[model samples]
Target: MARPSMDTDTRPTRLYSALRNIKWEYLVAGISGGVVSTLVLHPLDLVKIRFQVNEGYGVTNRPKYNGIVHALRSIARSDGFVGLYQGVTPNIWGAGMSWGLYFFFYNSIKTKLNEGDSKRNLGPGYHIMAATGAGFTTLVLTNPIWVTKTRLCLQYDKPAVSTSSVHYKGMLDALFKIYKFEGIRGLYKGFVPGVFGISHGALQFMAYEEMKTLYNTYRNQPIDTRLGSAEYVVFAALSKMFAATTTYPYQVLRSRIQDQHRDYGNIRDIVRQIFKYEGIRGLYKGLGIYLWHVTPNICIVFLLYEYITNWKSNRPDNHS
Candidate 1:
């Protein structure tokens, strides 16, 4: 009974094999994390938009509440908790798909890029490659979800009488209804800005990767071992902030394109409208609120993800 050969060229290392096997776990974790985070943070997201869009609404400015709590209070007082979670269905759908795609492609791309590279010398280029791959993948996979989420979130307190068609009730309802009303085109109202929004995703991954690399470099240690909990939070927050700042105007346009009620002749017309009506300032309408909303959320997400990944990787059974 000869023991299995450890030096066989045909067989991959245990760690390499294990890493390849966790694709489903990555998807599940991404989707579940996204859903839970969106639900918890949605109320704030609502307020953030209100503050961004409406000038006279006069929402509270307390740092603690940000926009969501104020919106929740206003809605609850005016409407109910129902208002707090106005487009919950779309949010969940968007989050689940967006995050699932992000993590799946991010891991896949990073793994492929790392295949021949020595683990001792992974560089900034690897991070950029991974981030770019994740960003592009997320853009295509979740654009429709974003379009739906924008519409649902932007439903006003006052309904207007218009000639345009109205479709969707919540998330799934909206999805099916949109398809029925306008076919495939209805669900992709903001395709142009949506594609542009890829910049945000790319920047996010780039920032995260760069920050991780920088930390590892400065400390002269392996990132997997040297990155502390606080470091993860800091890196995540900084990355999100940088990404948000660099591409915020596109984000505003993307939201507006999705949520608005207008018959633009084409993407050019929509862009013209955005610039004409909102001006330079209008293009950046929700920049502040976005940073407020996205930064902390990303920080928490990375923190949680790193902790979980590290814990699982370090488990006795998972060790190389």
Candidate 2:
């Protein structure tokens, strides 16, 4: 007369197992670092997005920016001091959630690969594997948020004449309108290019981890040995520079695909138009601003991540 409740009982056990496996310290540190860095550096990001979508024409009603200083001055002039932070709401949420999930997944994958041996050096291959998995997971989950951010950053006070020209009051409004008008595909507009951009994170993390491993080995210290903030900054900067320069074109492509003012048939169409009109350099629009934006962003993220993790590990209660 009674059906087995085994499935119900096992569900909670499985949930508990998953929760137990997560390293909460990594998640907290990652969210904190990402939110803080984005808060301090969002203007550069806004400028970068504007430049990325501008294809040498008046694509939107936004003011033209001749250079970094000019762009800042022009935005402030047109939209006032608050103009600089157009898409910061979605940007902060995206950054925090993305980084937190990335670190959580990355460490989980690495732990699985290590097979409970924390002292084992998994090397660069394992690092790459973990980072790639984490990047893919994070990208898919957060692509919609990024699409919303791009659109919001690209929004102007004055609307363009195109019927396709749209505006968002805020992050929630953008998501709802995009979904209502364009369906799920609209919310994931840049997802294809974002998939390629996964390499950016994978390469950055792999390089960062490798440098830390090598430094510890050279110092004859444990692989987990904590380093000073200055050391973390140097390593993060180098790794980010390498990754950013190598993988920047995808960012331009993603921004262009996500641009509300212009529409392209496909990635190939976008690439062909960009190449035909702007040449190879078209693919690297805003790279200088990107470099300026990301260098310090990575430094702060990695430094805080390391510091937070170290602090957690050193806590007396954490010693068992």
Error of 2 at 2 (Å): 11
Model 2 TM-score relative to the real fold: 0.92
Error in Å for residue 40 of model 1: 1.6
| Top candidate (lDDT) | 2
lDDT, candidate 1, at 258: 59
How does each model score on TM-score?
A: 0.80, 0.92
lDDT of 2 by residue, 88-135 (tens): 999999999999899988988999999967778998888889998999
Q: Would you give me the overall lDDT of model 1? A: 0.67
What 10-residue stretch in candidate 1 is worst by lDDT? 55-64
**Which ranges in model 1 have alpha carbons more than 4 Å from their true place?**
1-22, 49-72, 116-122, 157-164, 314-320
For model 2, which pairs clash? Answer: none
Candidate maximizing TM-score: 2
